[model samples]
Target: MNHTLAWRLVSGVKINHLCTPRIAIPSKAVTGSQQVREFSTSYKRSTVMPAWVIDKYGSNEVLRLNNNTEFPIIHYPNEVIVKINATSLNPIDVNMRNGYGSASLNMSRDPLNVKTTGCEFPLVLGRDLSGVVMECGLNVRYFKPGDQVWGAVPPWKQGTLAEFVVASGNEISMKPKSLSHTEAASLPYVTLTAWAALVNSCRLNKQKCPGKRILIIGASGGVGTAAIQLLKAWGGHVTAVCSEDAFSLIKDIGADEVIDYKAEKLEEQLKSKQPFDVILDNVGGTTEKLALQFLKPWSGATYVTLVTPFLYNNDRLGIADGMMRTGVTLSSKVVKHLCKGVHYRWGFFSPSGQSLDEIGLLVENGQIRPVIDEIFPFSEVPKAFSKVEKGHARGKTVIRVTESSK
Candidate 1:
C-alpha cells in the first residue's frame, strides 16, 4: 500500500489522526440530557463493526478491512445515524483515494479549512449510501428509527465505509421500496448531481422542456446517465455524446440521439442540428467549449460541470482585493459568452433529502431504471474502485456493505 499524507478540516472534529485502542468516544460534545442519552447508546453497544479503512491515502491497495467500534451515536439535534447497508463508489471517491481531484486533495489537507486546499490521509472513502436508520438525533424530526433511507452526506464525516455513519437528517430521504439497498446507493450522488445541475443550477423548467433540444457530453458517465433520463422526462430532445462502446448504453437510457464522440467532430456533427437550447457538459477540456458552439443564440443555455472551476480555469479569486478585481472581471465575461444568453453553473452537488425523494419517486414509477454495472462483496471495495478508476464502468458500481437480515 502506497501511503501518502494529505490534510482535511473536519468541522468540530479535533483529531489530526485517529488510531487504535478505541479513543474514548466523547461522551457528550453538546450539553443536554438528550445529548447524553444519544451519545451513551454508541458506547453501550458491544458489537465490533467491520469497515474498509485507509491507514494512509493512496490507491485501492490502501483499503484495509478493520474491526472498529461502532460509530459514536452522538447526534446534533439535526443529525441522523444510519446503519449503512450499501454504498456506491463515485469518481470523487476514487479521486479521493488516489489523492488527485481538487475536491479530494483539499478536503484531506484542510479538515478545518472550508476553502478547499487539499484532502487528508486515512480518509475512509465512500460517498453515496443506502441504509436503515438506526438512531435519530435529539432534534431530528424528519426521520425516525427503522426508516429505510438513502442519500449523500458531507464528505468529511465519513463512516459509511463502516457499519454506521452520522449525517444531517435533512440529507436523507426514504429509500424507494421498489429498489434494493445496492440499487438505491447507486443513485444518490448521480441523481443529486443531475438534480442540482439540471434543475437548480441549469434552471431547466419542465414547461420549457417540451420540444427543446439539449446536448449531454460524456453521456455514459453516472451523472451523464442521470441527465439523459431527467432531460427526457422533462420532454426535451436529448443529444448524447459518448464513446462508441457506450453508444448503445446511452441510447437505452433514453437519449433520443447519440453522437459517437470518437468518430466525428463534435461541432461539425452538431452544426446541422444548429443551436441547442441547453447543454450539460460532463467532460471539460475542449469538449465543453466545442459543445458551446452548437448552442442556440439567446435560447437560454447552461453549462454544468462536475469538475471544479479551478481545474477548468474558472478564475475564482479569493477575498483579497487584487484577486477580487481580476477574477470577477474575467469570470463575468467568460460566463457571458459561454453561450448566447447561456448560464454557466459550476456545481458541487449538495446532499439533500428532498432531491432524493424526487429521485426515488422517479425510480419507483419506472421513469428511470437503475443501471447497475457490477456488484462486489464488502471485501472487494478495492476491485470495485479499480474498475471505476479505469473509466470504462458501464453504469453504477455497487458494494455490498452488510446484509439486511443482520
Candidate 2:
C-alpha cells in the first residue's frame, strides 16, 4: 500500500487509482507551499547588492561602482529596506564626496571613538531617494512590502545610491501618486531643508504665509527653487535673487519678483523691496550681512541661512571644539541681529516623514511641481556629478536608478 501511494504521488496519478496515503496533499496545496518557500528563499538570497561607494573621499574619480556591496539589513525594528528606483544629487553630495563633513559624521557614527580611524570608507553618498519598500521590520506599522515611498536620507546614515537602503520609519512617507519616481526623488532633500528653514526656523506656514514678503538669495539652486514653490503655495510673495539666466525659471515657479544677483547696484534693487518678512540666504559670505539689511525690523521678521559653517568647522576642528566655536559664533550673530530688531537663524536639514506627507499633498493637488534641470541614467553618475559641480543649475539634477523609474 505504501509503495502504491508513493508511486501515485510521484507520477501525478489520481488518488483513487492507488491505495490511500496517510496524509493527503492537494495539487493546489503543493503549488502554494512551493511559492511560499521560493519567496522566502529569494529574500534571503539577496545578501549582496550593487552600489556606488568611495573608499576614500576625493573628486568624482574617487567614486567607484561595486557590484557586491553588502545589502543593508534592518538592525532595528523601526527600520525598513527600500529598493531604490530613483535618486537625485544635491550640493551636499558633492561636498561629501570630497570629504567635507568627515570629522563630524564620523563622530556621530561612532560617538565613543570605538571604531578605528577611516572606518567610514566605502561610504555611499546620495541623499534623496524614491522607491518601494521590499521588507519592513516587525515594529513598522505604517508600511509593508510593495509600498512606494520617498524620503531624504540623513547625511549620517548610509545613503540611497545603492540598490537597497535602510531607513527609519520616521524618515519616509508615502510617495505622491502624482509623481514618477524620478520626479519625486528631486524634491525631498531640498524641500525638507526649505521646510526646516521656513516652517521650523522662521515659523511661517500656510496660515501665516499669506501676504508675507519672502526674499530668497541664490534662488536658482535646489533649495532655493524648492523654497520658492513652498512659499508660493502658502500664498507668500516671493522675491528671488539669481542670475539673469535663471529669471524665467524662477518666475515660472511663482516668484513674484526676481533680482539678478550680478546686476550693478544689487543692494539698491533689494532695498527697493525692503522690509521683507523673511529672508532665506542660500549664498553664504557677504550676502548674509547684505540680506539682513532688508528684513523688517521689530516685526517678527527673520533671516534664515542654510550656508552656516557648522560642518566645515567640525571637519576642521574636533567635534567638541568645533561645536563650542559654532555655538559661540551662532550666539554672537543672534545677539547682533536681535539688537537690530530682527530674528536670525541658521537652518539645517531635518528629516520628517510628516513634513513629506504634507508636501505630497501639495504635489498631488498641483500646488507644487518638481523643477528638474537634467536627468541622467545610472551609468552616467560621474557626468551628473560633474554637471552639478559646474554650479549653475536652474534646478535639481536627477539620477534615474532603474529603467522603470517613470
Candidate 3:
C-alpha cells in the first residue's frame, strides 16, 4: 500500500514533500489479516524545510527561524521557481512586519475572505531578489531553467526569504551583466520605485527633463542616490539634501549643490534658493511643507513621496473609526496642496518588468551605479532589518542568500 499525499493550502501556503524508507517484513510470517492491519495503521513521516516566520507581528524579537517549515512549490500556472542567490530589504517590509498595514494586507492575502489572512502563521518575508530560474510553469513565456533574473515580488505573495521562491513570469527580467549577485540584488526594488516616481509619476523622462531645477531630500539613501543619477542622466539641475557626513558622496555622484539638512535654520537656506520645479522626497514628516517653500509655482511644479501612510491607516481606534480619522488627515493635506497650486503625488512600488528592464539597461550602459553599504549572509536577516531601521544607512543593506554567492 502507498501513502497518500495531502495538500493543505487554501489560498497560497508552502507545501512540501520528502521520502522515507519502508521497512520489509517476512512474507511467509505475515498473513493476509496481519497485512491489512499493518497497512491501515502505517507510520507516517513529517517533511520539513527551513524558513523565517513571524506569528503575530511586532518587533524583530517576534520573528522565529525554523528548519521544519514546509518548502515552497509551484501553485499557479504562470509562476516559475527561482533558486534565489540574493535578496534585499525595503521599508515596506518593516511596516508589514510591525502590523502597521494589517488591514489592507489581510485583504490582499485573503482575497476570498477566509478570515485567515493576517492570522496566517510562519509568513515568509522579503521583496527583491537576484537568482536563476529552476523550473517554469506551462504558461511561462519569458524565461527557462538556468536564466539569471531579478524582480520585486508583490507584497501579498509569499516572499523571497527561502532558498527558492515562486514569482510570476511578468515580475522578472534578466539580471544586469555589469553587476554581481549582491550588487544586482540591491537595485531592483529601489530602482523600480525611483524610476516609477521620477519617470512615470513626475514625468521626468528625457523630453521634460533637460535643465529643470530639482531638489532631492535624504540624498544619501538608496532611493535618493538612484534618483540623483536618473535626474542627472535626464539633464536636470540637481540640489541634494543630507547630513554633513554625506555631502561629499552626494556631490561626487552628481549633485550640482548639496545642502546639510541638519544645519540650523535649514528651511531658510532652501528658501534662499527658491522655485524648484520638482521635489523628490524620501524623508517624510514635514517634507511636504518644506518642499513647498522651494517648489516652482504655476509652472508645473510637482512633489512626490515614497514614504507615506497613504495606504496603511493608524487602526488602533477600530477599522471604521480609524478610517474616518485617516480621511480627515488625508483631505487636509490635499486641500493644502490645492491651495498652493503644487501637484502632490504619493508613489508606491509596483512590480514592473518594463521599469526593471529600463533600469537594467541603465546599469549595463554605466548610466547608473548601485551604492551598497553592507553585505550580510542569510543568517543575519534580523540584523539587516535593524540596520535599516536606524534610518542612517549610507547606502543599501543587502543579504547574500547563498553561502557561495560571495
Candidate 4:
C-alpha cells in the first residue's frame, strides 16, 4: 500500500459559529413562477467570474486567483447556479491541490475520454459551500432564485472556491436558518462524509443508535467532530480518540469518553473500551489494523474505515487493474474479518442532499453544530490550504468567499 497516499486521503477527508445575521430567502409567497420571472428580468448572465483555480496540480503555489475563469452553466434541467457566499477546506482539498486522486477524478471528469489530456486544468478545488440560488434550471421545483442552500460538491465536479458554482438540485438543500454562511459552509462535506460512514455503511441511525457504542478514531478533526455530535444526537455512546490536547473539545461536543491516541499504552486504552458496535477510522495506516480488534464478535458488529486504497490503487495503476486489485484486497479483508465474527467495510464520501435535509433539521433543533477552527479571506485561500496541509487542525478551516458572508 502507498502509505503516503493512504494517510493523505484519510487526513484530507476529515467546523464553527458566527454572529452574522442569517441571510433569509424569499417567502413562499414568491412562488417558483415568480422567482423565474424575477430571475429572467434581473439576472444578467455573466460569461466569466473571479475564482481560485489551478492550471496544474502540485502545491499551494500552483493556486491562481483568476478573474476570468469561465462561469459555470446549468447543462441539465435539474441543475441550479449558486452565487457562493462562503466555503470551507477539507483535507481532500489540500490533497487534491497536491495532485492526489487525479487519476480517478480525471476519469470521472471525462468518462468517455473525449476530452484531451490536461483538460482538467484550471480546475477548482473546494468541496463545501453555503450560497444562495441565483438561477435554477427549468425543471427545478424545490428551490428557486434567492433560496439559501448548503451542500458538498462531489470531487468530480468543479468546486465551490469561486464566486458562483453549479450543482444538482439533489446535491443541496435548505441551509439552516440559525447559522451564518461561514458556519453553514463548515458542515456539509465533513458531515455528509460522517453520515455516510455511520448511517450508510454502518447502518446506524436514530432508531438503531441508542444504546450502541461507537468509536471514532482521529476524533478531533472535521469528520471526527461531526461524527461525535451526530452519534450523541442519536443517543449513541461515543468514544472519541484524539490527541490529549483535543480532549476538551471532544468532550464539549458530547463525546461520552475520550482516549488519547498518543497515550503510552494506546492499545491497552482501546482494549478497555472493547466490543464497540462500530469503529469509524479516519486515521488510516496502523490504526486500521488495530481498530478492528475492538469490535464485538458475531453481534452484527462492524469496522468501517474511510481510508481505503480505491483511489490510490487507481492512481498508481490504471482504472481497470486498480479496481481489480482493490476488489481483491477488500474481499480478502472482509472474508478474513468475517471469519473472526466481525464485518469490515470501506466507507466513502457519498453526496446526499436527502441526508443534508435531515441534518439541517438536526441543526435547527440544536442537535448538531459547526466546529470551525479558522477562517480566511477569499484572497488567502493559499494560506488556508497551507494550514490544512500542516494537519493537527482542531476542527475545520473555512474561507469567506464573499464580503457579504461577514
**Candidate 3 lDDT (Cα, 0 to 1):** 0.76
Q: Which is better, 1 or 2, measured by lDDT?
A: 2
Residues 1-406, candidate 2: write the lDDT tens digits. 2322222211121122323233344446655233111111113346678889999989999999988898786667687889999999999999999999899888889989999988987899899999998766556788877789999989989998888899989999999998999999999999999999999999999999999999999899999999999999999999998999999899898999999878777788986775899999998899988989999899999999999989988888878889999999999999999998999999999999999999999999888899999999888888999999999888999998888885
Candidate 1 structure quality by residue, lDDT tens digits, 230-262? 778778999988889998898888888898877
> Which is superior by TM-score, 1 or 2?
2
TM-score computed on alpha carbons, candidate 3: 0.84
User: For model 4, how does the per-residue alpha-carbon lDDT over 1-406 read when each residue is reduced to its tens digit?
Assistant: 1111111011112001111211223446755433211111112336678999999989788999999888786677788889999999999998888888899999999999999989998899899989998767657888877789999999999999999999999999999999999999999999999999998889999999999999999999999999999999999999988999999999999999999877766688977665799999999899888888889999999999998899899989989999999999999999999999999999999988999999999999999999999999999999999999999989999999999873
Q: Model 1 compared with the native: what TM-score?
A: 0.81
Candidate 3 local lDDT, residue 90: 77
Measured against the true structure, the TM-scores of the candidates, in listed sequence, are 0.81, 0.89, 0.84, 0.89
Model 1 alpha-carbon miss at residue 32, Å: 21
**Which residue pairs in candidate 4 have backbone atoms (N, alpha carbon, C) closer than 3 angstroms, thus clashing?**
12-91, 12-92, 15-371, 15-372, 15-396, 16-370, 16-371, 16-372
